[model samples]
Target: MPQLYLGPWFAILMFPWLDFLIHIPTKVLNHVTPNELTLVGTEKHKTESWNWPW
Candidate 1:
């Protein structure tokens, strides 16, 4: 049907706008500093450590 076809067509056309919208928040809020990089290891010291607790 045209409605079903239109849905995908609209989504494909709008994907870049949607992606830009999604990227803004992550670009703004997901940056880490040099101090953060240095303190990334060791879960005992940094609560936000990139380690799996086991």
Candidate 2:
């Protein structure tokens, strides 16, 4: 038998890879951008200034 232990902070590190995992298949099958895949069915919002701090 195998057991797995995941800490509370695991998701913080795992989110990017998890997002990649989900996006790759969707991109291959649906030919959509990761942004599009993530924002599907959601209203588009204005780009935030904080995202570009330069």
Candidate 3:
């Protein structure tokens, strides 16, 4: 019974961190997608590219 209660509470506690994790890329993309922008505008650093044939 205690574990069951903790499970939901833990999820609730983690919700903000989860939301932050989800929010970052959307914010990053918000800059990238606009025509006046091109990249993350952070650095000349390297990144991995993902390719999907679909």
Candidate 4:
């Protein structure tokens, strides 16, 4: 039985995907800009869009 049966290898194979799934939230949140109350912040002056250097 030990030689014929195999454990859940799919979970092991899904390690990278699981890691990405866990990391995407942090990545998206890292890039996200919350609402600002002052004159200058991460977003543009007039619009709600984010400001990029490029």
Best by TM-score: 3
Candidate 4 lDDT, 1-54, residue by residue in tens: 654444556666688788888988787876786555467557646658788999
- Indicate the TM-score of model 4: 0.33
Query: In candidate 2, which residue pairs clash?
Result: none
Per-candidate Cα RMSD to the true structure, in Å, reads: 14.2, 19.4, 17.7, 13.4
The prediction achieving the highest lDDT against the true structure is: 3
Per-residue lDDT of 53 in model 1? 85
Ten-residue region with minimum lDDT total, candidate 3? 34-43
lDDT (CA) per prediction: 0.72, 0.67, 0.82, 0.71
- Estimated TM-score per prediction? 0.30, 0.30, 0.36, 0.33
Sorted by lDDT (best first), the order is 3, 1, 4, 2
RMSD after Cα superposition, model 2: 19.4
- Error at 3, model 2, angstroms: 25
Off by over 4 Å in 2: 1-9, 32-54
Q: Residue 37 in model 2: shift from native, Å?
A: 23
Which of 3 and 4 is ahead in TM-score?
A: 3
Residue-level lDDT tens digits of model 2 in 1-54: 122445645776798889889977777866544354354567778786666666
How high is the lDDT of residue 25 in model 4? 78
* Total backbone clashes of candidate 1, pairs 3 or more residues apart or in separate chains: 0
lDDT for model 3 comes to: 0.82
